[model samples]
Target: MNQTAVKRLYLMQVGSMPEYQIPIVCYLVQTDDNRNILIDTGLPEFIPEEASDFVNGQDVVEQLASIGLKPDDIHMVVSTHYDIDHSGRHAAFTKAEYVVQRLHHLDAESNPRFVANRPQWDQPMDRIRLVHGDTELLPGLELIETSGHVPGHQSVLVRLPKTGATLLPIDAVPFGEDFSRNGQDDGKNPDAEAIRASTVKLLELTEREQIGLVIFGHDRAQWEGLKKLPEYFD
Candidate 1:
């Protein structure tokens, strides 16, 4: 029972791999009351040496400026997971309280799989708000616990005023193809069972809610169809 609705949802394409046809994205959710919640940080100040050619774009900070916002303007940051591309510019947002799932912060802290990405997301821990299971972050914004891509990955469900409800199944369902399928054992992620279960969970939720639109995690094909930055989904 939300009293207010999300004003706008801006998708930012921060990085892309021409070889693999992959595009990295981060989202900004603007509440009716003018609160800003950035979903994931795009990339760091410097791209990795090996991935330099494949991944290239303006970082999250630069992208925010295009929409007349700075890092400090964001009140909250919803970290879906601590993946390399997702949690890069977290420390830049000095004013935001980071939101993350409890298990993700713990497991990633102790037994982190990505050694290179550890330093980027490990900081600003003092301002973290760790929630368990599905949570209504605000009146119109909800956090969907879809942990399949990583230890405790989560997705977002935003209810916009005119557009109705939109689901951003980040990493949990990487491509648009995943939406129609009953299972998600794509072999890309290690946990096949978790992927399948989480996929089904999202499917059920989408059907029950009659979601207005669904945005995949890193689908390059789907990415082209979405409105980005200055143009938003509202």
Candidate 2:
């Protein structure tokens, strides 16, 4: 019997940026077995200028196609939360399975907090798979529940033999520095207590699991310094 080895996972930057701001971060995680798992769908190409100020309106389909894959090729999509900029074009992958926290889906459906951003998330209700707490979606990838940014935010854990371990802690911690400080000092962010707890938990998990890399939701400075896709462990 042939074993399923997780060869590599790639991150495609499908967003734009300005001179000083950080480019939004959305990624496609391609496994060795040809499973295309997309992390987040960036803001749509056509958004209002006021809203676009906070979004990166790039061509996700074209970006994926650049690497020889199509939006339809995506097998799974893991959304950390239903923020406008993060979960905008989820409909692009019409046939892909979705992984999301249970609370996130519920909040996106009927919560007043998401009233302003309902259009971005409310449309993709049909393709979702809701779960509570943590989950291992596949052989080497695990979803860690770290809800702070929103009611049901979560991150992904990718364990590979060569790359060691990687924590894709979506918006829970926008950058590595967020983990270092308690939320009391982090300023206008999520709930302070939740943020602090999530940060500490992620740090503990990384140390316990021997994780070597961390990918944040919107940290361009960090993403720019990492290895790109199509380069996997042999």
Candidate 3:
């Protein structure tokens, strides 16, 4: 019997804020075929004055370099959502194709908050691949539309060889505490019911799939416990 090779996954810590003690990070998945998939880009070194104090100089390019990778090494960039903190430094990966939900792309284009940071994703339309609900990016990697924090928000589910299932709930459940409480209304997304529903859906999927681990977005305590860069979960 021939055995299938498992893809390698890494959690890259890009930046953090002292005030909230939240570390901004991204995930890198190396496919069996040697392709690199980036989940989300961290905040840019220079942000708007309103957010200047929160984000410091932690370059994503430098973070990738620490793992012996470069910006151009990335083949695919997956935007969980168009939030500034998530997609802020996406322009760094110039050669990669961007994957975003159709609804997200539309929302970012019209939403004034997203439009203000448009330069981060100013790449040509040809480089973008707009996916709908529940799209599969690779054999064992799938994008699950969670859509609560934002209209087109999604989470990634990676079926690992030894680890079984690992879910990346980026901002869909910003913190484990929020998940424990059944999610909160952030007022960013008007549909509070949709957010709650998405959270429940994730919980159901987690139970049904027997997910071994869940990486919550902006979870300070959880982030601290995770294996960072040079270290990774197989």
Q: Whose TM-score is greatest here?
A: 1
**Over all chains combined, what TM-score does candidate 2 have?**
0.88
Q: Candidates sorted by lDDT, descending order?
A: 1, 3, 2
Check candidate 3 and list the clashing pairs: none
77, model 1: CA deviation in Å? Answer: 0.4
TM-score of each: 0.93, 0.88, 0.92
lDDT of 2 by residue, 1-234 (tens): 665556567765656556546666667766767888888787766765546566454467777777798878999888878776677677778879888889778877787665655665555556778889988887788888887778788888887767778788888887766766454355666477787788888989988987778877667777777665544422
Q: Flag the better candidate by lDDT, 1 or 2.
A: 1
The residue-level lDDT of candidate 2 at 192 comes to 71
Error in Å for residue 207 of model 1: 0.5
Error of 2 at 71 (Å): 1.4
Show the colliding residue pairs in model 2. Answer: none
Model 3 global lDDT (CA atoms, 0 to 1):
0.83
Ordered list by TM-score, greatest first: 1, 3, 2
Worst 10 residues of 2 by lDDT: 225-234
Could you give me the TM-score of model 3 versus the true structure?
A: 0.92
After superposition, the stretches of candidate 2 with alpha carbons farther than 4 Å from their true spots are: 1-5, 16-20, 55-57, 112-120, 123-126, 181-184, 229-234
Candidate 2, 204: how far from true, in Å?
A: 0.6
Q: Score residue 91 of candidate 3 by CA lDDT.
A: 88
